[model samples]
Target chain A: MLEYFEILGQEVYKVLFLLVPILVSVAMIVWLDRRVWGLVQKRRGPNVVGPFGLFQTLADALKYIFKEIIIPASANKVVFILAPIITMTLALVAWAVIPMSEDLVLSDINVGILYLFAVSSLGVYGIIMGGWASNSKYPFLGAIRSAAQMVSYEVSIGIIIINVLLCVGSLNLKDIVLAQKDLWYVIPLFPMFVVFFISALAETNRPPFDLPEAEAELVAGYQTEYSGMMYAMFWLGEYANILLMCAMGSILFLGGWLPIIDIYPLNLVPAPIWMILKILFLFFLFALIKAIVPRYRYDQLMRLGWKIFLPFSLIYLVLTASFLFYFDKLPKGNF
Target chain B: MIAHSIFFYFFSVIAIFSSLMVITSRSTINSVFFLILDFISVGCLFIMVGAEFLGMILLIVYVGAVAVLFLFVVMMLNVAEQKQSWFVGKKSNHLPTGLIVSILILLELLVVAGGWKYKENLMSSSTLILSDISNTHQLGLVMYTDYILYFQLAGIILLLSMIGAILLTFRKRSGVKKQSYFTQISRNPSSAIELKEVESNKGVIIDD
Candidate 1:
């Protein structure tokens, strides 16, 4: 009983430790995204808050908190409220398996990648429920688009991950990183990496593929009926998911906590810092894509996902598997 | 052990309750939402039982893909307003048949559970769950080696279903103007542009 209590206490402590940093990072990421956009468009971004607008997210949080949450009379009240909570909870929970360093991570589960995949795939529920519960046409349309978009992209992402898994031969995130000690999977699996990155963009509903919440057509899409903290929850959940995808990209292809080079100077930095740096770099690319690329038309987005990325990733998966098998480079395991 | 049982009961109760709600919910959308809840709780139960890979797969495939598909259909059909009472709205001749089929299924499940003790020697099978390997690794070893044909057959079935769905929904609309990339890109400046000397007070006649 005492041992159980101790384990429970430790888990609570770890969760808090993990969650605080993540929440803080998410807030900063929101601000960073805006600033990056502003810089690309040649404008000053959010200079009114704390130094360099560091506390802008805090002000936004307070504004959302104090604002009234309006539940539409026509809406399914229970589901309407439940959607954002589900989104936020799933977004945060996926971090449990993400290792920051060798010693870090709340739960270093064997199937960490699959756990992330599951949580991300489940994210569609929040949007679908929210849109449906709103009892509005635009939200419904948005939900339908999201359902089709996410499902389409997930197939390609699954194939792309399998390409990496064939080489690593382990589902464990840590083992995936360690396996890339000599050479990151990005070098050999460059095409799949690109496919995975673009798919990740779509998976997180980032711009270009953010047809679900396209402002012009759907008027905020699934979030049309949301307000106050509920809306903020969705926003926060989105950034958190983006961060999760960046972390995933870093772990699978960019070698999670591994240094760029095995030389003395590059390896001098700590593992966790290297991991954070890679994630930030990926996030920078994410923000850059958002700034540069125009939003994709619905048909074009579907075509890109199904016709281009899906077949490409499938072929890549087959190529990777056969190459690994022929070269005897497939990691030996229990299988 | 206490923690394990506690979580087991917790997840199982939610799973059972949500599954009941899935059937009993008035709105079709609400039913789909409850179905998702049921899948999630059942997935939690699978994870708690140490089949983490299967648990995540359940969440990803069933709750994520299948339930979202259900929600999409429910929302698209706009059936939320059709709040018909179960077994009360109209005379349903199939109710007796449904009841009988459901009861038989329950009976079979009960028999399977209750008769487990009599099959003590059933544990001596060729394929045993290895304690050392991860569930995913075990699955791969069995699936890729012994059950490869069956796995490929399943893949073929899914592919056929996908092809069938696409073929069923696909239609050629005559009035719509579709973009033809080949024609659009193939035309050069000389072919696309035409310059003609126009006579005074006369418009240049262009050939279509």
Candidate 2:
């Protein structure tokens, strides 16, 4: 019984260890994103809070916490409150399977990638529930758009992951990274990498595909009715998911925790630092794309997902499988 | 073992309660939400029982895609205002039949659960569950080798359904102006533009 309690206590400690750093990093990333956005627009961004706006996110978080949460009179009270919590919880829960370094994960489950996929896919629920529970037109429309957008992009993302899986022969994130010891999958699977990145943008509802929150039309989209902390939770979940996507892209394509070159001085650095660097690089690209690209029209967005990316990824999958079969490089397993 | 049993009971109880709420909820949207809750609880149960891949698949496919579809249709149809009383509504003529079918299903499930212990040969099945491999790897080994044909057939069925849905919803309106990339791109400056000499007090007939 003592042993059992010890194990449980250890698990809780690990969860806190994983969660606290992630939450802090998420806050930092939010500030970094604002700074980047400011750079793109040629304007000073949030510099008044602290030195170079280092504490802006902290101040914002405090403000959100202290602000009164206003529930719409006609809203479904239970679901309205539940939606933000669901979003925040699901965003944090997916990190259980994500390895910060070789030994840094909370739970190194076998189906780690699938667990991530499931959690990310279920993210639309929060949006939909929030929108519907708000009992308003814009939110309803936003929910509908989000549902369609996420579902469409997930198809191509699934195929792209399958392409990666064929090469690695395992769903484990660690194995996927280890398979890149010789060469990152990005070199061999460049087209799929690009496709995956764009799909990730859509999946996270980032700009250019953020029709769900297109401010000009839907008036903050699904977030129109949300206020105070509940509103902050949605954006918090959004940023967490964006960071998660960046981390996924880094892991799957850039090679998680691996140095760019396997040299003497390069190899001396710790693995988790490399992972963080790659994630930041990918996030820079995300911010760059957000600044440059215009929002896609609804039909155009659907067309890009269904007509272009889906078929391209499908053909790529076939090509990958055929290449593996031809070269006899398919990772062997005990069938 | 005790912890495992406790977690099992926890998930299963939530699953049952939510499933009951899914059926009994007055609001259609509420029913859909309960259905999602039920899917999540059942998925937790699957993960707890060592079928992590299957559990994730259930969460990703059913709760994410299928339940979202239900929510979309429910919200779009504005069915929240049309809440009907359970088994007592004016148009509930099929309630008796529904009750009968549900009871029959419950009995069938109970029978299957009870009969599992008597099936001594079940342990000697050809496709033995391997302990060393992950569930996904085991599934792939069996599926890609022995059950490839069935898998392909399922793929074909899904493709057919997709095509059928597109065909059913597709409509080509007669008067709507649509962009044609072929024509738009093929036109050159010479064909699209002309500098015409105009006679005094006469308009240029550009079409001619």
Candidate 3:
């Protein structure tokens, strides 16, 4: 009994260790995203809060805590409350298998990438529930748009991941990172990486692809009826999801936790720091994209995903598989 | 051992409870939500049983994609007004026939399961391999090497079905100026631009 309790306690501790940093980083990334956005637009963002507005998100979080939560009378109260919780929980849960370094993950499961993909795919449900539970037209419209968008993009994202999986011959994320010791997948699979990044944007509902939350038309989309801490939970969950995508981008393409080079000074740095830096670089690009690009029209977005990305990735998948087969360089460890 | 049993029961109980909720829920949308929960719990059960790849696929494909589509349709339907029980309501006259057919199918499924005994003489007669590799690898080995032809046939069937769906939905409207992405993208500056020089007194005549 004592031994079992010890194991449970250790597991709990490990989970907390992973989660606390993730939550803190989510807060930090929100500020980073804003600052980067501000930089692109040539303005100071939230500079009144703390040093360079470092504590803006913290202040916002505190404000959310003290505000009154308004639940619409017609709304499905249970689902409305459950929506943000589900979003935040699912977004955070996907991080369990994401390796920060060689062994910094909370749970190093065999099918880590599939687990991530599954959790991320399920993310649409939170928004759908929120939109439907709001019992309003705009939210419903937003939910409908997001449902189609996410489902469409996920097809291409699956194919892109398959391209990476083919070379590594493993669904394990750590193995994927290590497989890039000599050459990162970004070199050979550059087009797939771009598509994956774009899909990630659509998946997370960031700007340009954020038709679900297009402020111009939908007010706040699924979040229109949410208020107080409930609203804050959605915001936190969104940023965390963006961060997760950035982490995935770094892991799949840039090589998670691997230093830029194997030289003396580069090798001296810790592995997780490299991972964090790559994530930040990708996050920076995401911020820049929000500032620079105009939003795509709905039809155009679908065309890009289905008409272009689907066929492109499919052809690349076949080519990569055939090439590997012809060369007999397919990973021997695979069946 | 005890913990494994506990998890197994935990997931199975939730699965059964949620599946019951899926049918009994008053709201259609809520029923779809419960169905999603059912998928998730069943997926958890699969993962607990060591078929992690299949478990993840169940989560990704069914709970993520299929259930979302179900929820989408349910949401669009005036769900607040839909309180019809499964056994009753106007169009439910066929329910009896449906139940009979479903039960027959269930019995056939049972027969299919029991007929696996004859697989002892097949090439991959060993049902489960206790190999050190992951379940995905084990599945790939059996699926690709032994049943490659059947797999290819299944793929063709799925492709045909998808093409059929598109064909059924696709309509041609004569007046609609649909965006021609191919022509749009293929236009180079030389092809699209008319570098016409106009004389000072005579302007170039525009042609439609």
DockQ comparison, 1 vs 3, better candidate: 1
Better of 2 and 3 by TM-score: 2
Residue A263 lDDT (model 1)? 93
- Which one wins on lDDT? 3
Q: What is the DockQ of each candidate?
A: 0.65, 0.59, 0.61
- Return the TM-scores of chain A for each candidate in numbered order: 0.98, 0.98, 0.98
Q: Candidate 3's error at B156, in angstroms?
A: 0.9
User: How accurate locally is residue B175 in candidate 1, as Cα lDDT from 0 to 100?
Assistant: 72
Q: What share of the reference contacts survives in each candidate?
A: 0.84, 0.74, 0.87
Of 1 and 3, which scores higher on TM-score? Answer: 1
lDDT of 3 by residue, A1-335 (tens): 89999999999999999899999999999898888888889998778788988999999999999999999999999998999999999999999999998888888888999999999999998899999899998888898889899999999999999999999999999999999998988999998999999999999999889999898889989899989999999999999999999999999999999988899999999999999999999999999999999888889999988999999999999999999999998987643
* Better candidate number, 2 or 3, judged by lDDT: 3
Tens digits of lDDT, candidate 1, A203-282:
99999899999999999999999999999999999999999999999999999999998899998899999999999999
* Tens digit per residue, CA lDDT, model 2, B1-208: 6776677788788989989998788787888988998999888877776677888999989987999898888888755346544334457667799999999999999999987765432223122344777788777778999999999999999999999999999998887766666799999999888788888999876533
